[model samples]
Target: MSPSLSIATTVSPASLAGTLVSNSKNVLCSLHWKNNDATKTNRNLKFRVCSVSGGYNTSVENVPFPRDYVELISQAKEAVELAMKDEKQLMEIEFPTSGLASVPGDGEGATEMTGSINMIREFCDRLLAPEKARTTRIFFPEANEVKFAQNTVFGGTYFKLDYLTKPSLFEDFGFFERVKMADRVKPEDELFLVAYPYFNVNEMLVVEELYKEAVVNTERKLIIFNGELDRIRSGYYPKFFYPKLAALTKTLLPKMETVYYIHNFKGQKGGVLFRCYPGPWQVLRRTRNKYICVHQQESMPSLKEVALDILASA
Candidate 1:
């Protein structure tokens, strides 16, 4: 059964507006900015991002993260667990589905958007406490992706798999019926995990709306799991073409704490860009079974710069 036909129901624009207006009023009432420094450092994230000396231990065995797929999921889970321990409401966890051989860019990695389904399920199962497991709602890019995930990766409706967009007859022409955030979230829900929302550029704008309408002033927390935001960060989606998504680099993304991340570069100067919550971003080179950190910075470095400049010199 196709996800569009089987799962998605028609939603009238008037009904969507009614629900959105109701939620928008509530969100607006509580909307206010937190102190900049407080938003960045108030959480006191568990991972201590400290200065790394030149002789810092960089062995892969000594490194806490995993290299293989199964273990990588665990590492991602741990990173989120640490982020959960912090006070940050918006967080992100991103990595390559293709074993870190390449960056998680569109049309490059090994079906990362699709492959992220199982990883989200496994890690969420491990990361969420038993009591909080059922309270987390997982949102996918489309209803079809939700149906596909339920059958394949989820193995029969383990968690609530919802979707950001509903396909329309004009979907191939870049049109979709967007579900309102107010209609999707329930009062019982405590967490919202959006899985690979990068499939459509508008999906991310919906995410920003979801944050503003549902999560901003509530006890709820949200995680952008593998949204491949680097596409926006790297300007792959030109601002002139995708102004909303491009603006996210400043608006929604700055508010997010990247709890876990890994992007790889393949070349003679190939290296990995890695960071865990509270840890400084590190540029690492694989050595046999281990990794050696050649550079570390408090802020994330550009993948191009790392691949071309930093690693080239290191």
Candidate 2:
């Protein structure tokens, strides 16, 4: 018989795994975080694999989702079932662009000043000088109003007036303290406001046309996500604005912002991050006098929710 040609090979655990995983001939298995949508909106952080084959050919062993992954799923479910008791407090403000110091248009800058700090102090010292103008409508109509009213004092330009509200937008996404009123507090109260650079959209026909045709029509039809569209149809306040009413969502936006942040994920060592992407306008729509954004019915738990659930189970 011809000399026998025998050869043998050995592999370290690490080397064996690396060799198996990289080989096209070896069977491959992997699990990745995938958005429900095939397009992959949010992919998972960690991917697990047992083998590497062009197709499913490897005999896989017990490979589990990371602990955090299990928890992520659990949290997602909990978030859905748990009561979303958040209130959306819409601040409906009405003010003229170049005119108005008295009407307290939309509860923004309803206070007026007399002259200087010392002037206000001296005025408050007088019989009606306490620097208070609550009942007085001196700040409403810009021109006819007396200039001396405490609440009527402001710079001629309204540009910076709206600029101050940006910080408040960041407040809407997270925890805030309100007087826990007789209305009973909900878990989430959407505290945010919208401002207009001009008096009212309706006051300007061009503004009005742009608002309806350019803004809402296009935004609602093309821009609105499925959830937002359903809400507009339902007419939800804090979210609802009567669309039939002659109103304008002006194009000129005051340079301002509102923002919120989502933090703390279980599986994610550093925590997952979620935030609201800015939109064209902080505007909502309503028809026939009803709220539109009734919360969408939850189909399933989100990854974050599932993470929480896993934590609880553990």
Candidate 3:
């Protein structure tokens, strides 16, 4: 018999509040701007207000503006606009379902979600814009061809690109080696994109190194194309891996500016995006045991909801 599946969208008010409080205390501090008639003149203030109220954790105090306050506000506005535009594109894309018809944990279905390639392309295009060019970095461990194709299509300077022939997480690299690797990440690199991180999640030390880089370098954003949640829940992964991944996510949540968990579920028509904040630890714990069967539509969350949540947080 197939394992039972159910849509997971039961976030209580308490959970939302917890997330907001956590975000306000940790991530959204630098984005906060003093309210004034000058702010009223800024077109992006509305976006800032929505971000703060919805869950960004920005403060609305009467602090004085900095010397280059205008420039700062302009940069923030651009970031907000870029994030909004990207979120919209993510929602409208017709997420191809050709490869998602099989049941989870089935031999090929677990590793062959080729349909997500389109989504990754879209993400790469958006993140490679000239405005985001310098600060956006993408690491693709498995898809060198895709990266090369994107470089050909989008130009070589679109974003900083790196590929690992072997999964860094699985390699026998020690902590210092990992740290040395992490040191290559420039402080200006704000966005970190990891495409189709499959078995890499099992490499806890490598994952730790990545998160440690984010912590040491603040304002870093993590966007992961993770399709392994269902596989983990189905017991394809070792029992210890789930807890370790969850713990790492929790530990990093309080440090990184944003951690977007973009998942494409099998048998679902669209992708589901999650903002891992406040209580990603709790969320991951709940998701670890849930088996999403082919027939369980109600058990899965919709892509639209996930997109909206991302916009609100942005």
Q: How many backbone clashes does candidate 2 have?
A: 50
Highest TM-score: give the candidate number.
1
What does candidate 1's lDDT look like per residue over 1-314, in tens digits? 21111111232232111010112111100111122221211121122112212323221111233445665666566667767778789998888776656555544533776668768877776677767767889998899888788778776544777999999899889899889989988888988999988777889999999999998888889999988888889999988988888999889988999878888777677878888766667777765545566666667788788888888987
User: What order do you get sorting by lDDT, best first?
Assistant: 1, 3, 2
- Tens digits of per-residue lDDT, candidate 2, 154-183, equal 333121111111122344563222211213
Specify the highest-lDDT model's number: 1
Query: Residue 233 error for model 2, in Å?
Result: 6.3
Q: Looking at candidate 1, what is the lDDT of residue 290?
A: 51
Task: Give the higher-lDDT candidate: 1 or 3.
Answer: 1
- Scored against the true structure, residue 245 in model 1 reaches a CA lDDT of 83
| Best-to-worst ranking by TM-score | 1, 3, 2
lDDT of each: 0.69, 0.22, 0.37
